[model samples]
Structures are given as C-alpha cells and as structure tokens.
Target: MNPSDAYLAHMDAIVREKVRSIESARAPEQEHYLGQAELWQRVADHVERYRDELSFIVRDLHANPELAFEETRSAEVLATTLERQGFVVKRGAHSLPTALRAEWQSVDFDPRRHRTIAVLAEYDALPGIGHACGHNIIAAAGVGGFLGAAGIGSGKIVFLGTPAEEGHTGKEYMIRAGMLDDIDAAVMVHPFNYDLSAHTWIGRRTLKVVFKGIAAHASMQPYMGRNALDAANLVYQGIGLLRQQMPPSDRIHAVIDEGGHRASIIPERAEMSIYVRSLYVDTLMDLSTRIDDILTGAALMAGVEVERSWDTHPMSLPVRNNTTLADRWAQTQAARGREVLPFGVLPDSQAASTDFGNVSQLVPGIHPTIKVAPPGVALHTKEFADYAATDAAVTAAIDAAVGLGQVIVDTLCDDHLMNKARSEFENAGGPIRATDLR
Candidate 1:
C-alpha cells in the first residue's frame, strides 16, 4: 500500500482503540441537588414534545445558509418562531441588524430577587461550507431550551440570537452594547464529533498589515521604487520562522489580501491579514507583541512604511467553564443516555475559537459539545456539513436542547449551585472589557 493509505489505516486503528477504551471506562457518579425535580422533568418533557418542531428549524436553517453579519433570513425565522411560541421577541437587538433577543419569566419570579440565565444561539454559517459548523443545531436547541425552561422555574430566561460568529465576534459587539450586563450565567452547546461536558476554547486576535511604497517601472528604474510586495513576503516568511519558537498551543496564519497588479510595475501597496491564537489571554498578548516586532522588522528590511491594525472585529477570549454548571449539564445528558467525557480526555489540539468566549468571560457559563457526526469527522468540512442535516444531527439537537433546558432549571432553582457558580466567576477575576485585554 501507498504511504498515505498506510498512514490513514494506522490512524483509524488508533482511533478505534481509543473509542473502545473510552466506552469501557467506568462513568463517574455525579452529585445532584434536590431542586424541584418535578420542574426539571417538565422541561425535559417539553423538549420531547417539541422535538419535531426543533428538528424542522434545524433542517430549514441547513437548507438555507447565510454568512456572517448577513443572516437576515435566519434571524427573522428564529425571532418569528419564538414569537409564535408566546415569547416576547426583539429583533435588531444590541444595535445589530441581525441580532435577536427573546425574554420570558415565570409569574412568581422577580428578576431583582432571583438569578437570571441566558441561552445563546449562533446561526451564522461559514463562507463556502454553509452549516458546516452546525450553527443550525445551536439555534434550534437554544430556542428549545428557552421554551422548555421559561415557565418551569422562577428566574428569568433570555434567549439570545447572536450573529456573525464565524469570523466576526457578534457577542463581543453585543457585550459592548450592554446585552449581557444583566445576565448572571450563560449556556450553549455546539455540535461536534464527540460529546464533552466542557472543552477548551482558545482566544484569537486578527491583525491587518499594510505596507506602502513607491511604484516604478520594474525593468527601467527598479532602484527608484521600494516594493511593498517584498515587505509582505518578508513578513510572511518572518512569521513562518517565528512559528518554530512559538509554544505548541499557539498558532499563527496569514493570507495576502492586496498584492498589487501588474508584474512589470513595482508594487506600490500590499496588505496581508494574519490571525494569532493562544490558549490564554496573557499568552495571546505576548504572541501579539512578537508578531508586531516581526512586522516592524519586515518593514525596516524592505524600506517601506507599515501600518498595523488589530481586531477590526472584536477578538475572542478563551472560555472559562464553570464546573458547577457543567456538572448539572453532565447529569442531564446522562439521563438522556449519553456519557460525556471530562475535559482532559480529548486532545487539546482539537480546540477552536468561538465568540461565546467573550460572553463566558463576563458570566459563569458552560459551552459543551454534543456528538452529531461520527469519529474522525472534523468540523467546517463539506462532509461534516452534510452530516449536520442527517437524522442523527437532528436527534442530537433535541437531546442538547433538553440538557441545556434542564441545566437552566437547575441553576435557577438551586440557590446553592447558583452561589457556587457566582463565587467561581468572582475568583476567576470576573469580567473585563475585550478591548482592555491588551
């Protein structure tokens, strides 16, 4: 067999062995609070009764995919669905044209006296691969969670539809607009290859480097012009070399946006976009400084003026998972017959960045993953996108919604758990403005 085929076979064998080991391992017995078990059961029953509706929403979103910041149709459909279900819906929330908000509160509950939780929904699809991220599932599950838990408990539940999570940090914008100021906790689930109680989501920042130079005829007066393309090339190479010295958890990638026109003419201006990611906010800032130095050195060597801009959109912070909340979710998912692995069981290299990280920093939260596709299926691929529409994905969505709803109910009814979550958030240094991280 060829080398590629051999490598694939070897990796598949390893994956199968790992799965067998995981399945054979004993499941941990989690502690549960006796906080209105009847209400929690009602939430689960609500999700079960509304399962077909939730599945239809996911399928509809999958059939019609929209990209970041332009998810008008998705937003409309979600808002309308919530409104029809008797939720007070608000479109264009937080000054975002495509963002949505729906609120519901039990009759005996007062927001001033009790805890409040938010269930976040992200409906934006990737540029070319539509629904590859399984945002459709996220949106439907979020709606189901809000509907299932709204009247079952005493506290207020907010269903937030955040747009543009693919590249733009819509939650960051909403945070700045005071969307999450009154929230106490947040919860959301993402579709993945494996079920996880909690997973690491790293921080990410974007940089745009523009180089300016004089243009002249390449063959005649090469000496009279400084090539901006040369600066871009130097910067790209410097970043590549810097990768060797970077930490294993850090990542840097770049793409040239403007590299000038004709070959006969010396390039006058060039621009390149680069993304830097790290597992911690402090590490991300340190890496940003290194990238800045490299860009400056590249400009100096090419004899060109360089301009650097960071985070044209809001940067994503690393997520902080509240163990108390995660435990509640784990118990709920266990009741549904899914065994969720703890954090360290999966390879940290599989982590990705999300706008929800910004919200998590502001509130105690749990962003769990529900298994939709089989093992070895990575997200944002056409294969994953196709699987997102299958019956398995729809079923996973219903289960995730039930879990999220039950967790919300638990958080609201169990005062001890809510207090523990708040204490954890406070001990973690609480919330900070995203722009102030640097």
Candidate 2:
C-alpha cells in the first residue's frame, strides 16, 4: 500500500475510536435554577410561530454573502427584519457603518434597576468560501432570540448586529465605542459539528515585520547589497526552532507577504505577516515577547533594519466561559432534546479563535456551539458552507434561538443565577482590557 494511503487508514481508525469515546462520555450534572416557566413557554411559542421568517433570514444571508466591514446589505436586511418585528432599530451603530443595534423593552422597563442582556449576531463571510463559518446562522438565531424574548415584561433585550468577525475584531471596536457599557450580560451561538455549552477559544494577536535593506546589482555589487529576504528566511527558521520550546497550546504561523519582485535584482524590502495565539492572556504576552526577540535577532544576523508592528486589527482575548450562564444554556438545550457537552469533553485541539472572546472578557457571556453538520465536518470549508443552508442548519438555528432566549429570560428573572454569574466574572479577573495586556 502507498504511504499516504496507510497514513489515512491509520488516522481513520484513531478517529473512529475517538468518536466512540465521545459518544460514551457523560457530561457533569448541575442543578437548574427555577426561572419563570410561563415566560419561557411564551418565548418558545414566539420562536415556533416565527420559524418560517427565521429560516428565510438564514437562507437569505447564505445566498448573499458579504465580507467583513462590508456587510451593508446583510445589515440592512437584518435591521429591516427587526424593525418589522416592532424593535427600535439603530443603523450605523458604534462608529461602524455595517453595525446595528435594535432594542425591545416592556412598558414598565427601567434600565437603572432591571438587568439588560444583549444577543449578538455575526454576518460576515470568509474570503473565498462564503458563510463557511456559519455566521448566517448566528445572525438569524440571534434575531430570533431577541424577538422570542421580547414578550417578557421585565429587563431589556438588545440585538446587536456585529460584522467583521472573520478577520477584524468588530466587537472590540464596539466595546471601545461604548456599545456594551450598560449591558449586563452577552449571549451568542456559533454553528459547529457538535452541541457544546462551553468550549475553548484562545487569544490571538497579529504581527507584521518589515525588513529594510540595500539593493544592488547581483552581478556588479552583490556584496554591497543586504538582502531583506535573507532576514525573512532567518526569522522563519527561527520561529520553527522556537516552537519546540513553546507550550503545546501556543501557536505561531507566518507567511511571506512581500519577498521580491525579480530574481536578478537584490530585494530592497521584505515583509512578513504572522499570527500568535495562546490559551491565556499572560501566556500570549509572553509568547509575543519571544517572537519579537526572534525577529530582532533575524534582522541583526542579516545586517538589515527591521520594523515590527503588532495587531493591525484588534486582538482577540481568550473567552472566559461563565459557568452559571453556560449551565443555564445547557439546561435549555437539554429541553430541546440535545445533549450539550461541557468543557474538556471535546479535545482542546479542536479550538479556534473568535471575536466573541474579547466580549467575554468584558462581561459575563456564553458563546456556545450548536450542531449544524455531521460529527467530522470541519469549519471554514465548502462542505460546511453547503450544510449551513440545509434544513438541518435551519432546525439547529431555531432550537438555538429558543435556547438562547430562555437563557436571557433566566438571567433577567432569576437574581440568584445572575449574581452567581457576576461573581464568577469577578473571580476571573473581571473586565481586563485586551489592549492593556499588549
């Protein structure tokens, strides 16, 4: 047998065994807080009634995909849908043209005393594979959750349409613009291969290194030339060597953005773009320092000057999952006939980064993953994008909406749960700015 075929056969057996392990694994049990059962029923009823409209929204977004910071049509459709549902809509919110804010409050609602919760929506698509990340599901489900919970007669429900989640940290921009100043808690759901109430999302920062050197004729004065490409090559090798000493959770990847124009002429400048990720803020910072030192050393060895910049876009901090909120989410999902797994059940190697992580560090939040595809379907692929528009995804969206709406109701009605969530947030070092760590 061919080597590639043998490797594939071996991996297939390993994966099958892992799948069996996950299937037999049991999630820890937790007591559910006694929230308003009647109100939750009302929320479910509203979701059931609005099922067709929600499906239309999800399909529409999937058909007309938009990229980050350029989701004008997506935002317009979402805003119009919310407006038709009796929400007070605000377009161009948080200094972003594509961002939106829609709110619904009861007649006697008092923002001063009553808790306020925000349901977030992401509609940005990937560059080539549109909706491969299933953000359309997020948008539709969030809108459904807000509308479903609108019938409650206490607290506030705000549906925020956040764009640019694929590459740019749109939530960070919104946070800096005071979009979340008065919000008590945040909730959002992402489409994935499994039902998970709490999963790990690591922190990520971007680095750009530009090497400046002198150009000279290759045949005439090659010795006088300092090749910037040499520096890039050296740094690339240094990062590979540094990987063995780094933690298993820490990741660094780079690409040569600009190497040279022609082979005959010595390159005057070269640029590299790199991404650094870690499981915690402190570890991320430490990794950043080590990467900087490596880049500087590469420039010194190449006898070239180097300029390094961090975070061309906003950095994404690791998500701090509020157990109190996540448990409520798991309970609600259970009622939907889904067994939502807690953290550590799934391999941490399956983790990815998200802008929602930035929001979680600022407020008590839960970013759970709802099942939209089969167990082995990977994200950011055309197969996943196709599944994102199927009936299975629609069903998951409705179930997720109902679950998120119930969680909001619980947060607003059950003071004990909210207090416990707040305590957990504080204990996790409460509202640390992502910029401060850098």
- The candidate scoring highest on lDDT is 2
Q: Report the lDDT tens digits of candidate 1 across residue range 1-438.
A: 331232243345435545543543445554456646677789989998888789988999999999999999999888888888877788989979999998887788787888889999999998889999999999999999988888876778989999999989989999998889889999999999999888878889999989999999999999999999999999999999988877666789999999889999999999999999977666677788889998899899989999999997789988877766876787788889997886658887887899888888889999999999988999999999999999988888899999999999888888888998889788768886687887
Each prediction's whole-model lDDT (CA): 0.86, 0.87
lDDT of 2 by residue, 1-438 (tens): 341232243345435544543443344545445546677788899999889888988899999999999999999988988888777789989988999999877777898879999999999999889999999999989999998888686888888999899879999998898888989999999999999888878889998899999998878899999999999999999999988877665689999999989888788899999999877776677788889999899999999999998999999998888877887887788879997876567876887899999899999999999999998999999999999999999999999999989999888888898999999899768898887775
For each candidate, give its TM-score against the true structure.
Answer: 0.91, 0.92
TM-score of 2: 0.92
Clashes of 1: 0
Clash-forming residue pairs, model 2: none
Off by over 4 Å in 1: 1-31
